[model samples]
Structures are given as structure tokens and as C-alpha cells.
Target: MKANETIIVEEQLSAPISVVWDAITNLNSMKKWFFNNIPSFKSEVGFKTQFNVKSEERNFLHLWEIIEVVPSKKIVYNWKYAEYSGNSLVYFELFENINNTTKIKLTCKITESFSDDIPEFKTESCRGGWNYFIKQNLKNYLENS
Candidate 1:
């Protein structure tokens, strides 16, 4: 984040680490909340996966290559769009509280061409979007299911 150019949004959800981890790692569970057209997905390291993300009128075709996976703890992947040439990294960290609840933290760092594009590739937008999806939608899906 450069000076006042980027926005950082952080959210904490109350759920067991196992449940949250499963929701993220399991392709079936992830599609329910995150992607509407996730034809294929995997959490295995070195695996390449493709998933579709649609929000209302806009559609996004996401291609990701799993870079790292630590069972029951963390997973990191490179996120890139088929239409876009640049790539970013998405990281998921799972922490366990004393009450058996999990504190899941999602950190996304933009490292490609988009980072240089000021108003177009707004960092605040990415932060807010990630916060909403992980804190609100993902929590609801994992807790209610």
C-alpha cells in the first residue's frame, strides 16, 4: 500500500479451523459460496486449477496454480485471469483459539502490472472484496451448512 493509495480490510470470523479449512480446500464447498462456475479445483501443491467467478452481470475466468499447501494450516496460490496477463498471490492462514474456534486470515498481495495502475487497479477494492467474501459469505456458508 503506497501512502494513501491502497486500502486494507481485515476481518475475523468465529469458526473452527477445521471447518474453515475444509470450506476453502474442498472444491465442492468452495463453489457454494465463492464460485458459480468452478468446473475444477484442487489444493494440492504444484497443481494447476481453473475456476469461474460470476457476480451478477460480470463474469471472471480465474486460473490459479497452487504454490504451497500446508495441511490444516495454510494454502497459497498464484491467481491470474485468462483475459489478464498479470498474477497475484492469495494466502490463507488458519489459527486456533482456546475455545476451539478458528481465526482465519486472508492476505492478498498484488505483484503484477495491476499494482502500478492507479485508479483502475484500486487496492482498496480488492481489500473490501476479499473481506466481504471471506468474512460474510464464507462464514455464512460454513456455519449454516
Candidate 2:
């Protein structure tokens, strides 16, 4: 895949950078809005975890390995599926905006393309998923709790 094939999702949250950082880095906090089934997660490089996500009656075993971390600022992970051939780098960056709000930029870079036969692996689908998670789910979670 090309470097420009990355899907970026940005959101301005009505919370401090610290709160947003905690929500993204803390395993327990992530389960509330990120992925409910994430068995374990750590903001340290080389840490790895796996979890399952079901969609359209298909189950995807998500394999994640932390590649880089800058506390309260950025985290990057290698994201792939156990049953798929493709791999991607997912980045979560937090910026401190005015008024204590946080600007979160999520970049999903497709390092390798998965099977095109699967709709879930399409770029549009990936973009939509990030939009839903960042703009809707995470926004609601941060604003309400």
C-alpha cells in the first residue's frame, strides 16, 4: 500500500489532553469507548495484545503490537488480523487545543492491503469505522463522562 493510503480521523474533544490521554492509554478506560474486548494493552513499545471483533457474522482476530509511545502525546501500534495477510500502523496523537480541549488525530496507515474481497478491509470502511469511533463514540464518552 502507498503511504498516502492512510485514513486519518480527527476530533476535537471537550476535555483536557490528560483526560484524553488516559482514556486512550489506560486499558480499562479504553474498553469503555475503544474496543470492549481488548484483553490487555500497554503504552510501552513491544507490548502486544489480541482481541476479537465481530461484524456481519464474521469474526476478526485483531493483533496489535505497540511500536512507539510518547506519553500523553502519541502512541503507535502495528495493527493486523490473525487471519488476514495485511498489516497497518495505527497512530493516536493528542494535541492540546485552546480552552483545555484536546485535538485527537488518528492515523491508520495501510502498510499492506488485505483481501479486497472482504468489504471490511476497504479504505472507505476503515475510514467510516474510525469516524464512528472518534467522532461519535469517543466524543460522546468524553463529553458525557
Candidate 3:
């Protein structure tokens, strides 16, 4: 992906903002729907974690560092891959609406160019991945959990 390219996916979930916040910030909840191999996670700024995700025939060594947090409102982090040349900033914002529905907005901006040879690094691939995680995976998880 090119530097500064951004992809966003927003979903209104049938859960409270607190629940959504927990789903994103809590390690157990995250493992349920996000990444199962996340060894450890903390919402505190500067906290860092690394894990490997195998997709198709490639292994991506995922790296992340928490950059900011606002309790149940927002969380920001820097995401990258140890084997790739790129940097991305991810922002998750939550809003509580009527009837306990919560709006979850996820924005991923490529702060630095990613290796273009990988199919998963394409813009559409990234967009589809985010949509699956937010609108489908997380949404189904929050509604059914």
C-alpha cells in the first residue's frame, strides 16, 4: 500500500459502548474475534505485542504498539509487520447510540509504503479484511456473545 493510504470500516453493533470497548481492549474478548494468537495485550500507551498470522502461504509477523487510548471512546495504535516495510496507524472510535447500539469506526492509514508484492497488502485486500473483522466478525461476535 502507498504511504498515507487509508481504509475505513464502520459498523453499528447491537451492544453498548462499554461492551464494544471491552471487545477491543480486553485480551480475552479480542482473542475470541480478532486474533487468537495474541499472547498479551494492554490498553496502555506504549504497550507492545507481536504475533504471527499465517495467511494462504505467507506468515506475517504482526507487530503493534498502543499509541493512545480514551477508555470507551477511542483507541489508536501503530501496526506493522516485521517482515514487511511499512507502518500503519489504526484508529478505533466508538459511539453510543439509542437502544444500546454502538457505532464502531475503524480507520487504518498506511503511514509508510508497504511491500507491494504481497497480495494481502493491496488496498482492496486491506479494506476487505477490515470490513470482515469489524462488520462481520466483530459484529456477529458482539451480537451473539
Candidate 4:
């Protein structure tokens, strides 16, 4: 079981806090960069959604429930896999910067142990995934839009 690890990824987006906040909270904006198959999403607490992501010939049913929201400042959610053993809390925080930019800090803390047989559940793999989404995808999406 690999559930004691915590991964934190930070990025400075070339957009204001409002823009960054909308990108993370708005379902339409999320589809463009986060997950296109997400049927529904909301920033309000207690909202739950599930979607399947196929990778490496495996089906991962992602379960997410919003746990906290502070408008444009911070949002936290529970992230887990329906068929997996581990559960984690993901926090997205935004800080306004000069020149209409926003600095985002993403923290993923594992609250329960994950099965070790899955390669994607490794700490490094999870870290890489977060970096890819935040650094490559989200950064480019907000910068260009």
C-alpha cells in the first residue's frame, strides 16, 4: 500500500485569479483541459461525480466529491477510484499575483493506502500526472485563452 505520500505541484498561470478560478471550477472550461468526459461538476461542497478513464488497457473509475470551496481562493475535494483501494484529498489554491497573473498550488494527500500492484498508483506516476496536467495542460490552456 502506497498511501502515505503527498504530492504538491505549483504553477503560475498568466491569468487573473478569476480566470484561473473559473478554469478549475467551471465545467465547460474544465472539459477543455481537465477531462472531457466529465458528465457534470460543481464547485459547491458535497457535489459528487464519477467518470471512467482508460489508460494502459485499464479502466479507472474516478470518484470525486467536492469537500470545500472558498470562492476564488481555494477548493478541496476527495479523489478516489471506485475500484481502487486508495483515497486522497486534492486541494487547489489560487493566489493573485501582479500583472493579472495567478499562482496556483495543488496538493494531493493520500488518506488511505492504495494497492501496490498498480503502476499508476505509484507516487512518481501520480506526481508526473499532476505535473502534466498543471504544468503542460493547464498552463497552456490559460495562457492561450
Candidate 5:
């Protein structure tokens, strides 16, 4: 079995904590950037949401189970794909800074056994992708909207 490794990404947003929280918890707001309009998410704890993700040559039907949710503060989920043998945890934390801005932290950990055969194992792609999605796309959307 492969031991899990966690990746954390943090960003300081110019938007207020409430505004940033709304952007993440509100389905419509999330659709604009996070899931590219294909995610129907329920922010309630224990609810499961499905998302359709597509790249240049492949499409994925991803399922996420909400594990923890605290309004305007934290959210956590379990993530897995149909073809993958491993499971992952995704966490989101929001902190209110002294400047009235929000500091968003996202962390993910993969728990599946990974070998050299799995291309995603030990690849920087996953972290890079999340960085783009959260720091660039989501951040821009929340700040601008």
C-alpha cells in the first residue's frame, strides 16, 4: 500500500470572507469556474455531488462525497474516480485576515496504492491543476464577481 501524501495550496484573496465563502458554497457561483458549469453541488454535509470533467482528449465522471461542512469556514470531501483504485480527501479552509481579506487553503491527499504504472502517481500535474483551478480561476471569479 502506498502511504498518502498531502498537498496544500494557499492564496490570499482581496475579497471578504463572506464573499469568498458564498462563491464556494453557492452552486451557481461554483459553476462559473470550478466545475466549468457541470457541477451540481450541495454544500450540506454528507451530501454527494457528481461532476463532469473534460480535458482535450478525455472526460471524467467524478463523484465527491461531502464529509464535513461548516458554514463560511471549512468544507471537506472524499474524491474518487471509477477507474482509479485509490481514494482522496479534499479540504478547504477559509481564514479572515486582518486586512479584511480571506485566506483560502486547499489541501488534498491521495490514499491509494500507487506504483510506477500509474502516471498520476508522484506527478506534479495534480497539484498544478488545483493551483490553476483554485488560485487562478476561482480566485479571479470571486474577486471580480
Candidate 6:
């Protein structure tokens, strides 16, 4: 509801930071869990990529630009939809936990608000999407791989 809201999802993966970072930064690994059709991705700042995600019969053009990257630690990107006026920042942070476990924190910060009529742009939907990815999808991929 708020103009600038942040959706944060954290998960402890039973893998090392390098593995988790690879999964997040590497395009090949990302396709297995994240956007399967991500055309291209690079960890360098200013790198950009775009992909289309279909939801409820509507196609959303996901526009992403890498803003920052700290090797094996953090990656931040400016995320927006071509069909929407709003934009957001998606941050992935990896923390080395005990016993070879890594803690991954995903933060999606809404820098600008989109129209309320679009349900998918709502904060609740954004939070739910991130939760599903970090808690279920990514978690399963890391643990099972």
C-alpha cells in the first residue's frame, strides 16, 4: 500500500556462500530456479537484461539493470516492468553461516509505486513471489542439488 515498501525474504541454505552466489549470479544456474527465460545477465554494474513473464494471461516485460555487485556477498539490481510506471530495487545478500551453511537475504524495495489497479504490482503479491522463490524454489534447488 505504501509508496516505498520493502519485501525481505531470508533463508538459510545448506551450502557455502560461493555455491549460493553462483546460483544467484550465474545465468545457467538462475534458469533452473529463477526466471527460466532470462535472456542474459551479467554481474557487472550497469549491465542490463530483459525478460517476459506471463501471469494471468498478461505478459510482463521485466527490465533489470545491475547496479552493484560485491563478489560472493551481494548483488543489487534495478527492477522494473516495461508495462508499468514503477520501479524497484532487488538485492541479494549472502552471509556465511556456521557449519558451511549460508544465509541468503532477498530484499525487494519498491522505489516507485505502480497503479493500484494492477494486482501483481501490489506489495503483498511482491512479498509472496519473493517468499516462494527464496523459501521454496531456491531452497529446494540448493538443498537438493
**Error in Å for residue 9 of model 2:** 0.8
Q: Model 4: which residue pairs collide? A: none
lDDT of 6 by residue, 25-120 (tens): 999999999989999999999999999999988889999999999999999999998987888889999999999999999998888887788888
Q: Which regions of candidate 6 fall more than 4 Å away from where they truly are?
A: none
Q: What is the TM-score of each candidate against the true structure?
A: 0.82, 0.95, 0.98, 0.97, 0.88, 0.97
How far does residue 17 in candidate 2 sit from its true spot (Å)?
0.4
- Selected candidate, larger lDDT, 1 vs 2: 2
For candidate 1, which ten residues in a row score worst on lDDT?
1-10
Taken over the whole model, the C-alpha lDDT of each candidate is: 0.73, 0.92, 0.95, 0.93, 0.79, 0.91
* Decreasing lDDT order of the candidates: 3, 4, 2, 6, 5, 1
Query: Which 10 residues in a row give candidate 5 its minimum summed lDDT?
Result: 114-123
What TM-score would candidate 4 get against the native? 0.97
Question: Model 6, clash count?
Answer: 0
Clash pairs (backbone) in predicted model 3:
none
Name the best candidate (by lDDT). Answer: 3
Clashes of 3: 0
> Candidate 5: lDDT over CA atoms?
0.79
Residue 13 of model 6: what lDDT?
Answer: 95
Clashes of each: 0, 0, 0, 0, 0, 0
Candidate 1: list runs displaced more than 4 Å. 1-10, 54-59, 115-120
- lDDT of model 2, residue 43: 95
Show model 5 residue runs off by greater than 4 Å: 114-122
For residue 28, what is the lDDT in candidate 1?
Answer: 89
Name the runs in model 4 displaced over 4 angstroms: none
What TM-score does candidate 2 reach?
0.95
Better of 5 and 6 by lDDT: 6
Report the lDDT tens digits of candidate 1 across residue range 53-87: 66565445788888999988889988777764456
Clashing pairs in 5: none
* lDDT at residue 60 of model 3 (Cα atoms): 98
Candidate 4 residue-wise lDDT, 88-127, digit = tens: 9999999999999999999999999888789998888899
